[model samples]
Target: MNILLTGASGFVGRELVRELQQRADISLALALRSPGRSSGPTTFVVGELAVDTDWLAALARQQAVIHAAARAHIMKDEVADPLAEYRRVNVEGTLNLARQAAAAGVKRFIFISSIKVNGEATVNGKAFGADDKPAPEDAYGLSKLEAERGLIQLAAETGMEVVIIRPPLVYGPGVKGNFASMIKLVEKGLPLPLGAIHNQRSLVGIDNLVDLIICCIDHPAAANQVFLAGDGEDLSTTELLRGVGKAMGKPARLIPVPAGLLQLGATLLGKKAMAQRLLGSLQVDISKTCQLLDWKPPYTVEEGLRRCFGRSN
Candidate 1:
């Protein structure tokens, strides 16, 4: 099978490429902005991501496509209209690729979406399910939701299988942003106020996410399905930090602070949304993925952390 994978240089895409190379039956055609940067037994097509970008070279003779590239969510707005920028790449670019793939006779398209499509946080201990109506809370989430809808409609019209996988807080080696910041803080033994946060959150390991994407490539049951991917275990912010500490062979120093006070301080500092992510509950129920595909995460949170931090032999 020839698979066209976009975003070959991204955090997830790099790891996914390593995983894909292990499969002897699959050949890769990487879609990158700079084809000269990648040297492998894979085909590299140079194309920008936008409404008018060409995808014929990437889609030709490919059996499936794993669309992993997108405009990532930003914490601060430097752009005049962030939604339009997000729509330009995530929605319009995605649909353009999907339509071209369908025209090229690609059988399956795997969309890597985010849990934000189900909303930022869970309500009253209820986990977000695949069947839940989308309630995207931000520009990035809304764009992803729009892309999913377009892909499903395209699938219906063209007989191409579309598989949507929504993952929450993916972590692994080379992780950046908030997850990396937290790890750095934990390694430094800095005092954190999140010990008082009692909210639960679901996180997926990159290996597990890559595994699920491979499963969706050829599974008949994955056609036109929306699935949530996670480690099947949820943890509180305090527990997550402690786990990080353990993986780093360090002790966590946690200072008890009320979640309300934390939120108030974040609001004053213009970090209320970031505070909510740390203190809020965002659980995902991945039962449908398991029941339909007979799949389970191959790595636990601890093992994933150990491997990521180089604590495992």
Candidate 2:
């Protein structure tokens, strides 16, 4: 199988490149925004993704495409029109690539979406399923939802198989942003006032997500299907901190603070969204993925954390 992978330098794309290269039956090509020295596979400089970006040279002879690039969600966006900016890349650019790939005889296109398309949080222990009605709460989520709809429509019109994988809080080695901050605070032995928060959240390990992406590459059951990706284990904020502590061989110093008081403080500080992420529940149901594709998350949460910290279990 010949494949073209976009965002080859990104966190998820980088891992996908490494895993796909190890397969003897696959020939991989990377579509990068800038020119870079190749590690092994052929690389194509496609420049910035947009509706008008030409992909003819890159899509030549490519059988499948794994698109993982996007503007990404910014917590503190300074752009005047954030939604338009997000749509420019996530929706328009994605549809543009799909259309071009279809014209180039690409058989399959796998899109890496976000769980935010389902909503910001889940209530009453209900997990977000792939078939759920989309309720995007933010600009980034809305853009992804639009992109998914566009891809499905394109697939119907062009006969190209489209697979959408929505993953929540993917974490692994070299992770950045909030996950990295938590690790740093724990490493410094800083006392965190999050011991009392009781909220369930699902996280996907990078290894597990990459494995699922590989499965969707050729699985007949994956054609035109939306799948949710996770580690199949839900963890509370306190439990997650403890797990991270266990993995790092350093017990977390947590202070038992009331969840209500924390929320109040966050509201006062105008950090309600951040607080919800730490205090609210967001779970994904990946049972459909397993049943349809006979797939399982190969790495357990504990094993994944150990790997994240460079420790062997």
Candidate 1's residue-wise lDDT over 22-128, tens digit each?
88999988888775654675766657788888888778899999999999888886999999999999999999999999999999999999999999998689999
| Candidate 2, poorest ten consecutive residues by summed lDDT | 37-46
Q: Where does model 1 exceed 4 Å of error?
A: none
The candidate maximizing TM-score is 2
RMSD of 2: 0.7
Reference-based lDDT, each prediction: 0.91, 0.96
Separate clash counts for every candidate:
0, 0
**Candidate 1 whole-model C-alpha lDDT, 0 to 1:** 0.91
Q: Where does model 2 exceed 4 Å of error?
A: none
Q: What lDDT score is found at residue 211 in candidate 1? A: 89
In order, what is each prediction's RMSD in angstroms?
1.2, 0.7
Quality of model 2 by C-alpha lDDT: 0.96
Error of 1 at 302 (Å): 0.7
